[model samples]
Structure formats: C-alpha cells, structure tokens
Target: MNITESIKFNKLKEENEALKEQLEMAHYFNQNLGKELDKLKQQILYKEDFDVLAEMYYDYCLKDNSKYDKLLSKEGE
Candidate 1:
C-alpha cells in the first residue's frame, strides 16, 4: 500500500473503534431508560389503586388507635 493509504487506513480504524464505543454506551443508556420508563408507566396505570389501598390502611390504623384510646380512658375510671 502507498504511504498515504496506510495513514488513511489507520485513521479510519481509530474512528471505527471510537464509534463502536459510543454505540455500546448508547445501548446501555437505552436499557436503563427503558426500565425507568416501565416503572413510570406502572405508576401511572396503578396510581389510583395504590392510593385507595393506602387510604384503607390509614383508616384502619386510625380506628384501631382510637379503640386503644378508649381503653386507656376507661382504665382511669
């Protein structure tokens, strides 16, 4: 090969390696972003269901604690 061709070949080889590295990084980023997207979708789909469940648990705790309060008051009798 001519001297000029050798130099051009080396430069292209380096550029190819750099491009491959960039492509790998992009793939990793895409995988992570896809996972995050799935989680957000789940939250959007079930937000109301989760809210209702949390409210039910909160109400049960409040009622149970109030019953304990009544017991304590009666004990002071």
Candidate 2:
C-alpha cells in the first residue's frame, strides 16, 4: 500500500480498538448497575416482609397499640 493508504488503515484500526474498549466498559457498567438494582430489590422485599411481621406482632401480641405508636414516633425522630 502507499504511505497515505497505510496511514489511513492505521487510523481506522486505532478507531476500531477505541470503540471496542468503550463497548467493553459500557458492558461492565451495565452489569454492575444490574447487580446493584437486584440488591436494592431484595432489600425492599426484605423490608416489606419485616413490616408485615411487625404489624402482626403489634396487632396480636400487644394489648395496647400505644407501644406501636411510640415505636413509630421514635423512628420518625
């Protein structure tokens, strides 16, 4: 190839390599974001379950609802 052609080919090759690297980085970021979202979903589910259990305890085991109210107020503070 002529010198100009060789230079153009090298430039294209470098651009291709740069694009591949960017794609790899984007894939890695997407995977990590998915993992973090899963963790957040699990935490929300856990919190819902715990809230249900707490409500059941307050409704059945406790004679006075005032204790539950106090706990709620403490949390707000």
Q: Which candidate number would show the highest lDDT if scored against the true structure?
A: 2
Q: Which candidate number would show the highest TM-score if scored against the true structure?
A: 2
Q: Per-residue lDDT for 62 in model 1?
A: 38
In model 1, what lDDT does residue 27 have? Answer: 100
Query: Taking the tens digit of each residue's C-alpha lDDT, what string does model 1 give over 18-50?
Result: 999999999999999999999976554333454
Model 2 TM-score relative to the real fold:
0.61
Clashing pairs in 2: none
* Clash count list over all predictions: 0, 0
TM-score against truth, every candidate? 0.57, 0.61
- Model 2 over residues 16-57: C-alpha lDDT tens digits? 999999999999999999999999755533334446788878
lDDT of each: 0.70, 0.73
